[model samples]
Target: MVLIGSHAYGKLPDLPAVAQNLTGLAGALRHPSVWGLPDSHCTVLDQPESAQQALDALHAQAPLATDTLIVYYAGHGLVDPYTDELYLALPASEQGRPDTALRYEYVRRAVLDPAVTARRKVVVLDSCYSGRALIGEMGAGDHVTAQALIDGTCLLTSTAETRKALSFPGERYTAFTGELIGILVGGIPEGPELLDMDTIYREAHARLAAKGRPQPQQRNRNAGGLIVLARNRAHPHSQAVGAPSDPTLTRLAPRTVPLLRRVSRRSLLVGAAVGTAGLGGAGLGIRQLLLAGEKDAGGGVGSAPSHRTTSPPAAAPSASASSSPTPTTPPTTQTSSPGGGAPRKALKPGEVAWRKKIPATDDASDVLLVDDVLVLNLDGTLHGYDRASGERRWTLRHDAPFARRLSGAAVGSGVLCIEDENMFLQGVDIRRGTKRWGFRLATEVDALDAMPPCVRGGIVYAARTGASLYALDLATGKKRWSYSPTGGVGANPTVNDTVVCVGVLDPTGNDVCAVDLRSGREKWREEFGLIEYLAVDNQCVYTCAMGTLTGLDLATREERWSQPGVRRDPTTDLQPLTLAGGVLYTTTVDGLLTARDPWTGTVRWRFNVRYGERFATWGQWSSGGGATPIIDGQTVYLGSLAYLALPDEAAFREKNRATHFVHAVDAATGTERWHFEAGGATGTTAVDATTVYVASSDGYLYGLAR
Candidate 1:
């Protein structure tokens, strides 16, 4: 990989500032990993004597067939308005412009010669009106002179002739260069067959759109036989042909209401009665009364039957002296009344397939279903439970005080990676849950908390609150590389094969960055002001900043599109968003659940729950709950406060405080399906197809079944 920039013009009076331009070029050059390669393999050439010299060096150090090559230039690029010939800037010796700086065709001739040994070549150009510099002209076939010079070369340039490229003061690189770096580092990795130039060009184009910059254009020349590998299969819903089908739709057996929703109403009432009678050993004492009602309904009696009388059953003993004694009810049963009546059975509370209590002193903070293992973060330890049985398998302990606050956990190569608020990175044996290694990053930075760590291949990437990024080995916890953005990193880093996408807060603005996972070099950078949350699927990266949501093409670091004015109240802070089944779910500070279209950014529906006293006070104490909303298929789950006052208001006033309720809403219509008072559920809820699990601050984990 090579980076070339020539901004150091000596006393050039008419041309734009070259030194400023070259500085930006150098920053990009030194960071080779940004181009999706290991830093050890890259070289930078700041000022070349001639196009021949630059080409000579590139070809002389030919890369192996297995290696990928990337070349980038950030300087003045001009084209002959008539012939549309491209040229790159060179240092001028005098105050006047030099006609012999460097022709685009000559640069192409030097670099594209088939004599070069590299298998794949990517060229990025950032210049004024750089779009016209691409190899092919408008409406022309792929075989331009530039394309004919090299085999398997891809070219990306700034803007078309009609659109102006953006440059900012104190920016080491222009928007184009920044966006290119963002994509190169973070773009998804494709297989050898898909590693072609045209794909890179398309990825870059998308990144620019997200940055609110003029869309970059590409001209494909000699790409007929080239194969551009895709990092992930295209989304089945994408406009692109041959999109991959969603496995969730294909693999799972169709839902059949699970035999519970089919029960009749009369059966439910009988089951409830039987359960009560069994506890009291009343021996079907209420059967006669129930049968009499049926006879009247059949018109067998002139007037309603006299009410039956029965003695109340004795109360059962209490488990504790501080609480009143309660009856121990027998499980309900299906039974028939007299006169050969139809049988009835009440719906039973769903069975508990399995349950396990956390250590008495600890509580679970999060649970992740990774393959067959259920990983739980409880107190300050990580535990793995069998998903099918909820049986504890193993446990790994970390020394960080705030380990319970860890948000993200990913598994790779049989190693589990986790990040804690203390900026501690922990890696554990996935099967045994034994601590393999751990590292404390930014020991001197007090505010530096590491976001959740994501693992790809054998490497783990994490972002820190202080604007730092770290790549570590999955097995050894060794630091591979680190990068600091102009702003601090707050979002969890996401890793595809080649790039690591991170959200950062910088002096210019809050932005998302794509860094080369191998070299810690920035591949692309796109700025947004006050970014809040980020999530990525197979095809696009979704981010929320201010009140708006934006989607960018993951491969190009370009914004494919955006949704502005999302109508969120300024006072309501948004929590991390979750996307599943083509829907995006998020929560506002005031406890409203909002769902929107992931592609179009249109709100599907919003559900609001009335807050009770405890929730209102908790919001006042903690700013607002940062719990992310949960989604399972077509249902959205959220926790809210519901207050109920005692009838004797003066007496036991303190005991009648408000309670928290977990509400399950239908995703399609935003209507509440069921509301259960859970009492002080301060954290997020988790769900499988049949059950919803939530934790309460009152020291319990409640499981409710559908």
Candidate 2:
């Protein structure tokens, strides 16, 4: 195995992530549970001075490989404008000069040389335009010898022909290689015992798509994808691991869980710590919560409805005590509705409207409100219920035999868009509860899901998750136009009346740009840092990146204001901005709901979640457990998703069930109006004039009303 990375570019933008990629990938390949390659077998070339250094390394290593020969490179990829051939960039390479770099043809010839006796060969490229390597014939054949074929070769590239590879500013590794290392180390639970090339590529592709990064390109010849690369470390009976004696290799850490969307991110049932802590801790907590569910069914603290019934029963009145700390001022009573609705007789704030116990998995999307129906996406099924009565109205399940899960969904303009496991975005008429049109995004499917699409103004703005941003007409489901940035779409598109803004991932650094809504032309672009979240309002565009919250004026397209410290901890802190009623609502890693004036960046008020003695543990406070604040009328519904912490290891083992709460706070004053406890951690919430719908991980959907 030969690993090569060039970080020092003379004139072009340098990639600092290359060095980290080399170290991390080498470790994953040497891990006992993975490839277990001997120390002498793996060769790493970091910042090679010239093409000869790399060529010499490959020549020296390829002949000794008896089973497989793997060649991996990470750096800038240049295309010769004259011949349009790919070149692997090095330290002396420039932006437009491809002659200074190493021609990729030489590398290909070395992989297919007759002297090398390796049965299977793999070439992985992590550079811009690396996919151009797949243009020509791969294996050699001869009619004189009855068309004898050479060994099959598999090639994986970081980006397509026109796209640039991405390396976020603060990320430890390049976006493409980071995901690859993650799978090799963490291992796919449902994958086969031996991880093959195709399985690895598909898993990495889906994960990148889910985060709105660039999708990779792969080319396999003569069953090349079937070549086994490593053993699945996630399997139970894999290997009894041993410590590595090599000083250069360290055990690779698990990948950080992504921020899905504003709604899905905040609606997650568990925290990042639990998500990365492995299945043991999470399983123990879930088991304890299952017992709590039984207690709720038997009339203990929680409210459980009849099993799988359409109209189960109305929940009992919830307690009115404040679960958080006491506020400086009490919430004032309001008689008139602010958002254009007549005031009716108001019930107690925590009172429940209805509760239904459905067979929902923990991976539920945000509860969606569409006209007269409430739509909820479970694993592979979509269930629609009557908004007023909580009775089941319709159901739709994905029909794909292999990719049966639904990744994400969006509802607006009387239409619903659901992306199935097959990467097909299906448009459903929400009023009639039937499929309107279906558009297949990709030909492949896997366990990874995508971010929900954005629907507005008779158009559905969707992304191919790292490839292109597309605008689809709602009426016809035909694509209006697509804009492919230098990198790929980094996140879901944020649209407005005049322009649509998106975060574009790149090897240099991610960018946030605005495009004309009608023409799909580039209006303006601001080269920003790694974009965590993107949002737009009538007057300005807001983005959170590198712990700073920046606002750009819409008409002037200039920086309005910038505020740092929004995200103190990059890994765990998620600063999702919600713009409503001219106020920018953001959450902090320390569990504070901060309301800011969007124009001047002035602080309006802040609502803090206090973890009392019962929930206290060692660590900083959480970012409201990834739940973004949802504002409706004059009320803001905030689901404080559970962050599990215990006083000791014994308590963490025995009593792992942590309770979550939904607090209805005064939108204007940031004071808690009421709070309701759930059987398990709460996710995102959807609210109407009269009721608030909450999705809980404990397999119940509660309709809380005033």
Candidate 3:
């Protein structure tokens, strides 16, 4: 473990709390209940004179540890004005002179060196714009964030890429580090005996949010959370009377520790009820099992305060529902209701239904409807709420370390399917918040990644990137059949009753592969430049690649129509194509909303959705936000990323701030009706008969009504 802190600077204001941050964190790390590393093992680099000096100490100490390597930095982080690269300030470092300071790239290169053979690596950055390290080369002052996660490592940052790290006037240490150390020494009550990186980060994030501080961000890969950092001293066994030696107080081991399975009270009760005859007496058996599980699991079924719900008020006529002539209904399969039943009433222009505050960081985490329950995944936990009242119904936690934007989710057969942190496809009961089954998707790096899983009938189709596609039973999670194309399935599959169409990533370029839905037999394969989005119906399969949209016949396997200059980003645009009401809705090359004919790529109309801009900057109003439009009745709802221009000095210090807004537009003429402003950037959304649920980056889930 190497702890570095720089508290002095030449031009910029000094950060005095960095010194205490190092001292406090070191003490917590050496505690008997924590890591308990010896004095000789822990290295302290206080106020290193040069970047090379810090790199030398880090490289020297990193290679000796065979178990885990922990490197933490607490200092003023500087960003280059020209390149937007990050730097760590030293004692003699100036604000704008990055050459005189320590380049974070040098430190990253050292920690990622091949000579460092530590079993696990963890890096903690408690500085401004530290989150930039999570990505590859960044854009020149763009407020948009991207992910290029490092494999086999865990990274925790103090703030977002465009935000500043906070420290109050008289605090002992920095905000993020202080909260982290408190959790390490104090131990999380009702938590597991072993504290992993995921658990620690979740607790600290919640604590800092409650205190109105900037929330932190984390990224993990290759099971980095399995590397246990500290032992929980607050477990009941640690204070038990006349008990055996408490394992929670033991010293750290050199190998990874398996996470204990958390058995909820509901599961234990069901288990007892199923085998009451074999358990001798129902009363005594139930009591004992409940006691055992409740000791560690604090919140579960029948916990009134934790899982509270309020009845939704009686429905009334929408005041803003102006009586317009009902338009002709199209003969399309897509409907707003999950059951494909009657369509719901569209939200009117400039109407507000309900607004809620929620912790929604992952843009890939979608809003799904399972009957009357609204399901959303925040961080690593799955949340179910009442769709009508916005009341939380239940929550189920995943043991994995980090949440990924590409970890897609789907809902069908009354079950919600999602890829967890361990790369396992888990089928969860959307209404009850219980796990039905889990299926392993990959076992090695060759089968490392997967696109979002799509469900049809009783079988769920999942594609492992560059690997084979598997059809699993939604109820049992057992593999029904597996299909491996020459090139693996690259994008999410679109399925109808008979066939499943997937975008294939070949060695040379990309292709579109179609397979039989039930038998997993290859039907046909064709070449496309690089698929960005895909959709399917009974007659044709639509694919967007290289800024072009093409329609392929289902039977002939020939191109039906081709149109160029279709704009999309596969990493962020989860649902770019919406086929409904006999019309296709998509974004154009210039980020304008356009209604097109699916059979013949002819645009009906285009509407400019970019409205507000705080500055007259380049590309500020060029493209619309990336969120896909949600269509119901006659209105299309879309969320966008808006910019906020700060004062001249503040804008120079930080490039710009980005906010979010949701707009309602007419589906017929492509005219924007109403738009509701949100506190942060928006993600995917789900709608009901009268309510539209939206997920935002400002830690809020909103429900807009007419």
Candidate 4:
């Protein structure tokens, strides 16, 4: 195996995700000395030409047929919107000029030239539009199995062609590469081998989708056989976490300390029963699980809830019932809570409260509900509808005709705040459908997602993709203050202890700048290997970086404690860390939802969001809040779209039918209560006291009874 990255761009501000990408994937390999094959080298190239030269030399090496040759590239993959042509950016890359970048299609074909005798030739890419590396088009980003082979040539990518690939700001890898490394280092849970590319790709595709990232694409067109590399070696592999090493981390070997949570088999089995309840009439018609964390002497996760319905659900109404052209009235759901007119429970087992197709152009943003009104930002318009009836109430728009898509959105200060396509932050009056204010940064970077920015004290703290951290006055849309510690600021600004902490990343390294909210002056700055994302409470800032989960004192900026390689299951997406009930709630890129003791960084409990698949895990989303877990009361709701790679698909499908699911887990004990699988739910699920609103990529905004 060989690794090479070209991120030290001379013209473009360096693509730092590349360096982090190669390091994490290359770190776990035990070399020829350990396994005794021709040595697998991990190399970082300075420029595109240099990387190409190195790869050419590898092909020239031409040794024994027994050896397997691998090539990995992490940088920019550009697709011309007009011509649909693909190009890979080199260090000297200047988008749109010829001879400035390498043609990926040509290079991909070059790698498989028959003269090279190595039995297997693998090409892995992490860049924008990398999926185009495969000559064949992949309709879905999540799963691709090799159909035919011409030689020992195969390929894997970070994301599909239309979307950009993302990296954790302070981690050692991009989403796809990190997950690839994890799968390589940690073998399948109970089984032994983790070698097959097909197996690896399936799991990686699923993991990326779990966290809301563009699914990785794999095309093993030529490899005739499984190429096995490395062993299932396990040890206490502790990371210095690639930074200005801190005493809090160095004092203890991270692995020696016990994990805060462990997987509860009994609770999980019961949870799966609830998740699969509607799959068949045989599937239990359970409504909810027990309120978790109800402890006995053992202090274990709570038991299954008592909301069970033995009867089969009523037949679903015709699709026209909700979509028909008729004056609407709030439909009533029969519930035991108080008046039967209002819905008080989530969807009953096998029952569809209502499913209406949205003529929506984009499904990236979620549905927001406030009282009886539901809001959805679709195709440059914010459409409002009646929560109970799904009737259109109002529509707001400010974009040029058919020219806009949303990055993300939030509701605050009586306005529907949105980050628009041109990097403009706009606030629209929610009730009147009028634009209050719009602010566009001078830079060209896109502000994709970061929980739609934090709103407090009449100012909005916003972070943008092209690299900027600014505080805007909500009333006038004027910049209160601006900070750019690094060229790229992708994560959101978090406020706690009266200080604003923002994580920035570029080729230099990952740095967290703590600025005094009042003065907008830097109070302290910490440099780490990388900063993935941060969540803060009154005393601590929970950080998921360097493949480890750590906490930093909010005021002092001192490390409180750290858990190295926290999610050891070969899954890498930006793991979301949240603070609730004095415990940290986290969801991994691989679908493990966990509760941890904040004081000690000890895990309290673990629940697999993918539900009951044996030897299965989660997928990812490009970071900035799409897949982050949201806590509503004692319940945590998440949208899960899992890809199952099973030994027997028939058996697995019989038990669990839907790959796309929405689940509610107990915040206290991390026990899942109920799961509803409808059209694929994409992001943080929005809810009100009476209804759980979910926006699906399948063009429907489901109004489930809650």
Candidate 5:
């Protein structure tokens, strides 16, 4: 298997951050499974080149009889407003508008042409406004003939046109790429039975959507013919391939410490039955039963006599205790508290591993792990940490600081890229944590209120706060190209091999655009007045607009299918998307999180967090505020604020004060796991294998052990 990326990070004036993200992407692709085809048969091309050169090389390569070829991109995309044509952004010094960027038609003709290869081709895009670029009609940016390609092409994009893509502070790639790497690196299961391309695309889209960005879209033309070779699978003969040779696999191993088992099977069954009966209705009873299974085993109703009394008092007696004489001293005589004596501290400093303080800022937005480094965005400064020891490595501060609010980061090659509230792009060195270059919009604009910048190849793609989009180089901080809309650019851009896609907001509503990465030319544009977010797969681009979600063809930008009744508001900042275990997860402003079918957008399960109590006060014109949902395997995390007045009348009048609470839920089924109260939490949450990390307005970073 081979993966190739053609990314343009706009221009390089002084930003090394773009370069860092690109470098990190290169490193991710360097994994053995991605390019180690039996005997190292894969090649990567991230160098600067003209659209013609890139297409020519792709066309020249001989078709493979049996194998897979994966092509990826991270840059700018364009779309033609009149004809809905798509294009890819490229490095063109002469052309500065959207009319001259690389077109998708050209890419199709040169690289995806059916005659060029018999092997399956997989294309992944991490650019702004990528959905529009994939399937729309060829336009001025369409520099190549349309009748030049064959079939068996697979396509994937980061977001739809209406939503923005993000780059967190420490991420080596955009959220899309980070998730992709996570999937490829075993964060997601790999196998023919685990998930197909369509499923993966849908999951990826949902995951992104939950975070307030559009989901990645996909298109698979060959149905079952498109084969996704796992990127992290090792050779069968490798030493790590077989079952564990250690005794721990079959028996206890040496030096192993034993953990106490807290709950018994009888206790669990009894607790579940009682909890179920207490919930009242059948649906709630079922929900409670499920919740019972998820609760801390030792903390269930069966373990507490007082909890059972709080209900109708018809609860059954403990099953275990009924069979034996009750001890005079109760269960406390049999077992001690898990903590022994004192209440355990929420988080110990030693458990912190490492900590670094932001000079003058109190808030940070995103964090990511690239190779052995941890990157953090603290207010306006970008900090790097040694992943192993959590030691401070370096820091990069913005010379012309925009907003104190930091957004996201993307690391490539050796550069670290980040964005601010004003949509300013900054690039830094990963090793030294020093600023390499930076760029400001010729016109002051904000891409989307909370969206982050994305980097690919050596280009950085960012959406201004108003309505303009830009692509810049990582090394020199030069402006490669820019795109402005009659409406504002609301969505972040997603880049594939030869195209970029973004969402635009006008007085009438929302639309998606496909742009060329190299020349800043547009290929096609599609309008959906109600759409808010987008996701891509190999065969189609999925979008959520108005109150519905739909899929569009990648090659022709035509609507393939539509799923209705999926509505979200503008103030609902996060994308609310996640993909895992062949499922797409999304959250809405109404406090509902859903797991849906990626192909059809049908609801699989819906989880509600609303508790019928107003939690907090809202600014003028705002209904309510909530954080985006986060998913880790079978667990989902959510945070929100609600208000409650001292008097019922005052509360009903919306005059009550509110408090915030953080919740953890099960991803497979909509069930609450645990909840912790806090002042407020913004942005997304991060997780390691053993703990969950969250930041709040209370001036404390919380570490919740799993």
Candidate 6:
């Protein structure tokens, strides 16, 4: 048996789901009736080249026909649009280039070719582009002799080439793998002894379609006799499709939410470290704090926003703290009620102006709003649409020539800076979406996928994933200077005129270090936890992994206030803080949309946005609170849906799992002004003056009038 996957990717964000898929299948195959937990014969490969080596060795060492070879692979599977070929990436493999990835032909020759002696062969693919393997190359019908057809050869693919395999938020395995494991453990209708290869594929396909997921399928090859895989270990009386997953076998980790937005340079989860230390060891009980107006540096005894320009941070309506609050008394949910002073003008999220649906695409980044254009990266192309009309404006196929993955543009300095996973940075004219300048990395240096570059003052401040930091001229893509640190580099730099703040780590502890933007000299380094995200405008660093949000002085690097464990319900933590229109917003695992004071960590208001009472049947679906909140001018929007994270992993991903909603709340007052009850709601949100755009996991991008 061969199990291969690449989870520790260097040039791209690591997919934790890969690890889940690997371990889940490995456990299922070891059932007593299957392989009987035979550790000696199984081979596991994590690297791309290593998998090829193992396959080549198999051909040289072809042995007996009794040997049944089983193959399982889960990773980033890319289909070259130019060549119409599919390639599977290894840990060190590059995205677009075929040389770095394992080609499908190699897999076909190693496993499907008659020259190899294995009589029984089965291949299972669980990936985005996995279905491509069963197309033209492996077409059915007459091919060669009847002797080859008699051999019990089978192939199972996760989804059609056009659809993407969905990931569970906190479950151990993906939707496809989880269902497959259940069937192998539980006996079929005819019992485990009489189960055939076709039954396995058909059962998995039914399970996927039932969950509103892309249907997995099998072709003409599943025509063998009964192939007993394992003894039925599930309860004899129970006949549920998913009743076989052993509770003991389900491995659980600290529940984590994967951020899908592209506003930051690197993914917030990967670019951070969840250390034991909390906010430099400052422990403050934030559970009972009431909503209070934001106080400036001197007013609240905390550091103020950097005074680089003459203008100060926007003033919010002052809200005084409430008297001793009991646990039962939640924060007030009044829309026009400003706590301490006169009511502020509540934002009116006007009715829908227009709603349109965009074509479903692959690996899409969050919808971006730049210069009145809504931009989203799909497959190998970047599409721009009119923010109001939803009309196609321009399509940027810059990466089409190389087929490399394009980083969403970081717009500033009249240019849009894009970083490719292959270590090439390009500057494009923002309005025209035309490439103006490009810079390629030297051979000796490696690019970091977790540390994205930030553009400020016509300069780009970026850190290499495994090396040092560099500042580049945005207009010309020229390196200004480089600073080599001792260890790995992190992303989301908070750049002010005086210094650029970066998160760095070494053997000791995680730290937030400051460097002089002009000189590239270290100004100060503070012992702090690895930062999940840094808000530069307010000099705030948040570690969502630890549930701590700390404010810092950009000039002095001193701690203003630290709010550790500031979540409404402790089931899951808040997403990294998002700042817009002078207000900070984040969602909680318990379905609370929270607005906080920028400097003092005071609660502005909290709104409960659960799916419904019917959803209460499943206690908590998903890491329910991980959906991100978007701030559009004076309004805050959230996509709220329930996902069954426990009990059953695939319960919530249904064609109709229950009704879902996208809410528009007044930023200042935490009151729902308007809402759109679109089912299968997600955090993929972007807004303009006229409309709001949202994407559902069910392959639909909806445009709603605001």
Which candidate number maximizes lDDT? 2
Candidate 2: regions farther than 4 A off: 1-347, 363-365, 400-409, 442-449, 565-570, 588-590, 610-625, 640-659
Error of 3 at 36 (Å): 85
**Would you estimate the TM-scores of all the predictions?**
0.45, 0.47, 0.47, 0.46, 0.47, 0.45
* Tens-place lDDT digits, model 1, residues 233-303: 12221122132332321221111122333545333210000000000112221112222222221101011
With a 3 Å backbone cut-off (N, CA, C), the pairs that clash in candidate 2 are: 266-626, 266-627, 267-684, 347-706
Higher-lDDT candidate among 4 and 5? 4
Task: Give the higher-TM-score candidate: 3 or 6.
Answer: 3
Residue-level lDDT of model 3, residues 1-706, one tens digit each, is 5676777666667777777777777766665445455576666778777877877788787777565667677677777664456687777788789898777777767766787766556777888767555433111111011111333556777765545676655456677776776666556655655566655766666556444466676654433433456655454543322334334322211111122134232321100000000111122222133234333332111101111111111111111112211223221111123222233433343345456666646343446654557776666677887765577889888787323431145554456677876778888887689999988877657766656666654567876677778888866888999887776777667776468888888876678888898799988888777787777655688887766778888889889999863333332232356554345667532345666767777776666655333244444432334455555434566665322222335443233222255666665556666677665555445654345677766577777652
Query: What is the per-residue lDDT of model 5 for residues 1-706, given as tens digits with 9 covering 90 to 100?
Result: 2233333334511112234334444443343323222323333445446666555545544243233445555655555443334455555412245555566656555545555434445556665556543332111111010001224445666764333355443334456665554443332321222233443453354334333344565544332112333322222322223423322111110111122133242321100000000001122221133223322211101011110000000111111112111112101101111222322343321133223333322332434434334555555566676643445688766655534322234444445555544445667776677777777653443334644455544566666545577877755667888898776676656554466767787667777787887777878888766555655444556666655667778788787777664434444433423433334556554455676656566676666654334234533111222344544433556654222112335434342212234566654445666665433333345553334454443344444443
lDDT of each: 0.46, 0.58, 0.57, 0.49, 0.44, 0.49
Give candidate 4 misplaced runs (Cα > 4 Å): 1-351, 360-365, 379-381, 398-408, 445-452, 486-490, 505-507, 565-571, 611-626, 641-659
Tens digits of per-residue lDDT for model 4 on 1-706? 4444576767655556565545445444422111222233333344436435644644444332334555566676765533345676666667676367666655545554666555455566777766555422211010111121123445666764445676544444556666666554443332222134544564465445434456665544322213334332221121211223333212211111122134333321100000000011111111111011111101111111122111111111111112111222222323323212433454452245666677733334346654345677665567787765676778876663211222134443345556766667787666566778887654553544433355444456777654677777755667888887656664557664367777777676577777787678888877765766676655677677766788888667788899863452555554445543244666654556676767678776676765343343423321112244555433557664332222224554443333346676654445666667664435455654334666665577775554
lDDT of 6: 0.49
Please give the lDDT score at residue 214 for candidate 1. Answer: 58
For candidate 3, the lDDT comes to 0.57
Error of 6 at 373 (Å): 1.7
